[model samples]
Target: MPGTQLTVTLSGGDVADARAVVRALEGSFGAPDELPGDENATVRTATFSAAAEGASGRPAPAPSGGGQEGGRLSAPVTVTVQGTPEAVARAG
Candidate 1:
């Protein structure tokens, strides 16, 4: 079956830091099938497949209830998370 995919686009901050933020999400999702874009780009994107097999050959865990907590980034960043309606709800 096709998986639920999440495309995260990040702008502002350096590409490396933006990539770091996306990689951090792997703890809850999994390794992205499509990694962040060019290192020199001001904006980059990463895509994660929720139902796809990970390195362990198992689907990544479904994200569940969580509340946002105040935090600070090294620099200002604009982030956009896009996915199916169901997937976006699950991510929340």
Candidate 2:
């Protein structure tokens, strides 16, 4: 059976911060499969497979209780990482 996938989005902060954001995620997910058009875009996005821990050794903090619905955010410096329950949890 196929595994799962995760869509992680990080926005807000200076547009230049996009690089840093992607860098942070690299620890969890390998280099972004895709990236925003503008390198300095405030809103950056990345996608990762379930077994995408070939980037960094750091693991993202696990999420608290409650379900995490995949959706957009209306805030600055917002990070939305969504995927299968397991993938999401792992990415968290």
Candidate 3:
């Protein structure tokens, strides 16, 4: 079966803020095809790929905010997550 793809977009904050969220998700989704850029764009996006749920050995565990922190967000952000139903559920 084809793998699932998740695309997350963060707005209303700088790249650092976006990176934080992305990094947090990386714990579950693995690496992203697109990483947030340093440029001062209004939006930042990251795309991650994963095998369909139950199609692989096991899913990655969700990330925790307490241990080994990912990063801090300087401000609030508007996140837009897009993908197939399975992909969205996995990312959620």
Candidate 2: tens digits of C-alpha lDDT, residues 1-92 = 13567787777755445445555555555555665447556667778664544334344432232221332223447778887787677556
Specify the highest-lDDT model's number: 3
Model 2 / residue 84 / CA error / Å: 1.4
For residues 1-92, what per-residue lDDT tens digits would candidate 1 score against the true structure?
25577788899887656766665676656667766668689888888786554566444653342312333356888888899775565445
Clashing pairs in 3: none
For each candidate in the order shown, give its overall lDDT on alpha carbons: 0.66, 0.56, 0.72
Per-prediction TM-score to the true structure, in the order listed: 0.65, 0.54, 0.73
**TM-score for candidate 2, residues paired by index:** 0.54
The superposed Cα distance between candidate 2 and the true structure at residue 52, in angstroms, equals 4.7
Model 2 worst lDDT window (10 residues): 65-74
Which has the better lDDT: candidate 1, or candidate 3?
Answer: 3
Model 1 poorest 10 in a row by lDDT: 63-72
Better of 1 and 2 by TM-score: 1
What is residue 14's positional error in candidate 2, in angstroms?
A: 2.9
Ranking by TM-score: 3, 1, 2
For model 3, the run of ten residues with the poorest summed lDDT: 51-60
